[model samples]
Target: MLHLITYKYNFIPAGEQALHIVFPEQINISENQLIQELASQLRDSYEDEITDIAPAYRTLTVYFDIRKTNYFKFSNKLKKFLVNYTLEKKNTYGRTFEIPVCYDLEFGIDLADVASFGKLSIPELIEIHSSTRYFIYMMGFLPGFAFMGNVPDQIAMARLEVPRSSIAPGSVAIAGKQAGIYPVASPGGWRILGRTPVTLYTPDNPLPPFQAGDSIKFKQITRADYEAIKELDAHGEYQLKVL
Candidate 1:
């Protein structure tokens, strides 16, 4: 049997060509999943009029071609569609990905600092961080960069006051209640917890295997395993373990 959850939402004009469907301002998984489902439904139902649909934590920004449809007409259509929308509770929502991470000091530069801030030993911090399966609220900032969330309050740390000039790719990090992995080498301020060996992004293939409405669980691994996995991944031999 499935239960139904009621949600209140509003549509706001983003610009002449785009609009936003705004929901409650919170990081709840159920709401985000609904946003994802709505995005998919809109794309399928209004592909001819809509150019793009971007789903975030609490908003779905939809862009439509003015030639085919204006904001007012589209908004009215969306309003009617939403009035009839219903989300059925499910036993499972999205795929769960197990990411292998190495928390050695060399990669996790801010490991000690974050552990200290949490008043925990390194092992305790690692255990707490890796235990939770984080939901991918959205993917932004860069390709393959997933903004996940709700880190355990005990170990949730804030971003660095000053951003780093260069952060290596595959860096697993946390900021406040959010967690993410740096898909590529880029400047970032998120507190570094560790690094993953998987190739998250590449110019040849920009789209990531994962996307919004998915789940990620980090698995702690040794440095040796990291090197071995890195080698296999580089050769396109390693496959990500997913549930």
Candidate 2:
């Protein structure tokens, strides 16, 4: 017996040899978890044109093969699955990562300001930021950089008015309602409270340390240790990036 539920879909002719499933607004109810779990189910039930599935803010987009599966049957089956969807609130689909950060002046250019804005001293900032466990909402903008958040309101801040043209890789930053690690060297606007030793965007790597619904923690490390990790990472034989 199917319950009362509704879904809307669109078809796209992509060159990748697969149909795309777009759940744009349907994300608000039960997002990443729903997409991942539901995708597993739908993929198992239907064996056609499924290249990959990507989940974003309140939306899930899947790529599939059009010839193997027509849109009508695909939509019907997906609609039924969604109507009977069983949402699961979970901690992580990937791995919980403990990252080391150096709030030292050499790397952290905005720490003092962030501390001042939050009315906390340097040590207080460290304690507050490191103590709290954050939720990883999604990974985008660049590889390995998880769009994460839910920082306790007390420490939240708005993004920089003028986005920086170049931010060093491995920067750890925060913004309105969220905080995250910078995975690559790129233009960014997030206020950096510190810098982590973790290398997030590794070209040719399929998965980063984070995935949707993952949890991240900040651990304090001395500047010396940060440099040592940098050296080790440069050698390319270390496991700096985790599940």
Candidate 3:
């Protein structure tokens, strides 16, 4: 149900200019879209005060200028406005991102383990992961980390017992039913199958290259292609070119 209650919050003191609250339920893809939409509304109205809106698995934190924006007042306004915030089941938008995966034995470090767990051949594992389409649920844990969903039923697997020291960027890894890209080089536990050429995170770029509610389609590439892409990246001209 959509919330209509004019939330009266003493949660903020007079001196406080900003506030943050965590919701009880973990937010999935569509729910995040709603939070962003609501924040967009506030942004349109009070461009100066509402500095930014961040969405997570189950919560949204809004940042604003306390000197320019009243914390309690803005909270009450949002509560009342979102009473009709499209609570009904809605559709997730857009075309599928055909991300190319270089699944040569070298890149797919955990391909054998995944095949063993699923009782499938290595070729079978690659076939399954590439054929399926996934929906992005959230973007967090790190910048541009697209928490996409619904790996093939047969391909579902658990994270490694211990996280890796560092996963290569563009690594398409699956932990439980959720899968994600490394975005930037970082430590993770997800069973990495292959690396993509996609540049998921770039600091100099304005706005992240991705957003909530995007689709993903994995395609296979070769070791040579991976090396070529790596070389391009070394020269700082990286771009995901599907083969």
C-alpha lDDT values of all predictions:
0.90, 0.70, 0.71
Which candidate order results from sorting by lDDT in descending order? Answer: 1, 3, 2
Q: Which numbered prediction scores highest in lDDT against the true structure?
A: 1
lDDT of 2 at 188: 91
Judge candidate 3 at residue 86 and give its lDDT.
Answer: 46
- In the range 1-243, model 2's lDDT, one tens digit per residue, is 222244454445344444455555522324545556666776676645566666665555666666676556665666676666654454444566788899987777788888888898989888988888776767787877787766666678788999999989888888877788888889999888788776666767646756777778888999898888888877765464342
Model 3, 1-243: lDDT tens digits are 444232222223323555553444543555555555555666787677777765555455667787775777877766665555444445655556677789877778999999998899999999999888777767778877888877776878899899989988888999877888888889889999999876767777524455666777787878887778777776878654322
The order by descending TM-score is: 1, 2, 3
Model 3, stretches more than 4 Å misplaced?
1-27, 87-89, 202-208, 228-243
- Give the per-residue lDDT of model 1 (tens digit) for 103-136: 9999889989989998999999999999999999
lDDT for 220 (candidate 1): 100
**TM-score for all models, in order of appearance:** 0.94, 0.79, 0.77
RMSD of 1: 1.8
